[model samples]
Target: MIPLRAGTVTEVAVLGAHCDDIAIGMGATLLTLARARPGLRVRALVLSGAGTERAEEERRALDAFCPGAELDLTILDLPDGRAPAHWDRIKNALAAFRAGARPDLVFAPQRGDAHQDHRVLAELVPTEFRDHLVLGFEILKWEADTPAPTVFHPLTPELAAEKAQLLLKHYPSQAHRDWFDEQAFTGLTRMRGVQCHAAHAEAFVLDKAVIDFGGS
Candidate 1:
C-alpha cells in the first residue's frame, strides 16, 4: 500500500446516527489524532439520544477519546430507528453543521450501512460537505453489511487496547449489547490490521478523493 497522508489536519468533524456510533466506528483514530495534534478541533454531531443518559455517555466518551482537543458536540432527540422519516430535519441540521466548520477531515457512516439511520446521514453528509474529504467509518453489528474499505488507519497495539478499554469504560449503557465487547472491538481491529500490515487498525471507505502529487 502506498500510504496517503492527510497532512496537518487541524480540524475534524465526526457524525453519527446514535450516541455510541462514533466511538464504535472511529474511537481509535480520534485518540490517535487528538494525541498527535494537541488542541485539534473536533466537531461531533449525533442525530439521536439527546436529553437522555445515552447523550451523557456520549459526551463523556468523546472527551476521553479526544484528549487534548477542542471538542464541540451536538446531540439531537430524533427517535432512534426512524431517521428516514425525518429527512428534512436531519438535512437541515447537517447543513447548519456544514456552515459552521470547514474541517480538514470528516468521519461519517458509509452509504451502504445496514442501519437505516446511519445510511440516511451517510447519504446527506456529502450533499452539504460537498468539497471536503469524507471518510466513511463502519459500525459492526449483527447485520452483514461491512464494506471493503478503501483506506486504513493503522493503530499501535497500545492504542488499540486503550480504545477497547475506553469504549467499555465510557459507555456503560452500551455494555448490554452482545456485540459491544472487548474481544469484538479488538478482533475487528486486528483483522483490519492484518489487511494493512499492522498490529491493529481502523478502516474507512473513501468514496471520493482529490489527490495532489506534489512535484515539478
Candidate 2:
C-alpha cells in the first residue's frame, strides 16, 4: 500500500449521514490509526440520531473504535432519509466543523451511495474540505452501491475481528437489522483484502491525491 506522506495526521474529520455509517464503513481503519498514533484528534459529525438511542449508541461505538484518541463528536437532529430537504442545516454543520479545525484527513460517504442521505452528505463534504485528503467510505447494504475503491487500508486479522466484535457489542440498536452481523462484516473485509493481497482490508474511494515521490 502506498502510504500517505502527509507527515502523520494529527487530526481527522469523520462525517456520517447516520449513527453507524462510519463504523460500518471504516471501523477497522479508525482502530488502526488510533493505535498507530496515540492522542490523535478525531472530530466526528453525524447528521441524524441526536437525542435518541441511536446517538448514544454512536457515541459509545466511536469511543470503542477510536481508542486512546481525543474524540470530539456531534450528533445532529436532522431527520433520517431526508438530507436533501435539510440542505441548509447540513451545510451549516459542515461549515461550523470546518471552521473549528483544519483536519489533515476527512472521511465521508462516497457519492455513488444509493441512499439519498449518504449521497447528499458525500456531495457536501468536498465543498467544505476542499484541500484536505478526503477518503469516501462505502457502506454495504441491500442495494448494489459498492464503488471501485482506489485506496485500501489493509487490516490485520486481529483488527478485522476486533472491528466486527466492536460493532456487534456497541450498537445494540442495530442488532435487529438483518445486515448487522459478524459474517457480513468479516466477509466484506476479507474480499477487500483479496483485492489488496492482505488478510483483511477496508477500502476507500477518493477523487484526488497529491503524491510525493521525491523521497524513498
Mind giving the per-residue lDDT tens digits that candidate 1 earns over 1-216? 889878899999999999989999999999999999999999999999999999999999999999999999999999999999999999999999988987999999999999999999999999998899999999988899989998999999898999999999988988888998999999999999999999999999999998776865
Q: Rate the local accuracy (lDDT) of all candidates.
A: 0.95, 0.92
User: Which sections of candidate 1 miss by over 4 Å?
Assistant: none
TM-score of each: 0.98, 0.96
> Compared to the true structure, candidate 1 yields what TM-score?
0.98
**What pairs collide in candidate 1?**
none
Clashes of 1: 0
- lDDT per residue as tens, model 2, 1-216: 656545788999999999999999999989988988999999999999999999999999999999999999999999998999999999999999899877989999999999999999999999999998999999978888889999898888888999999999999988888988999999999999999999999999999877777897
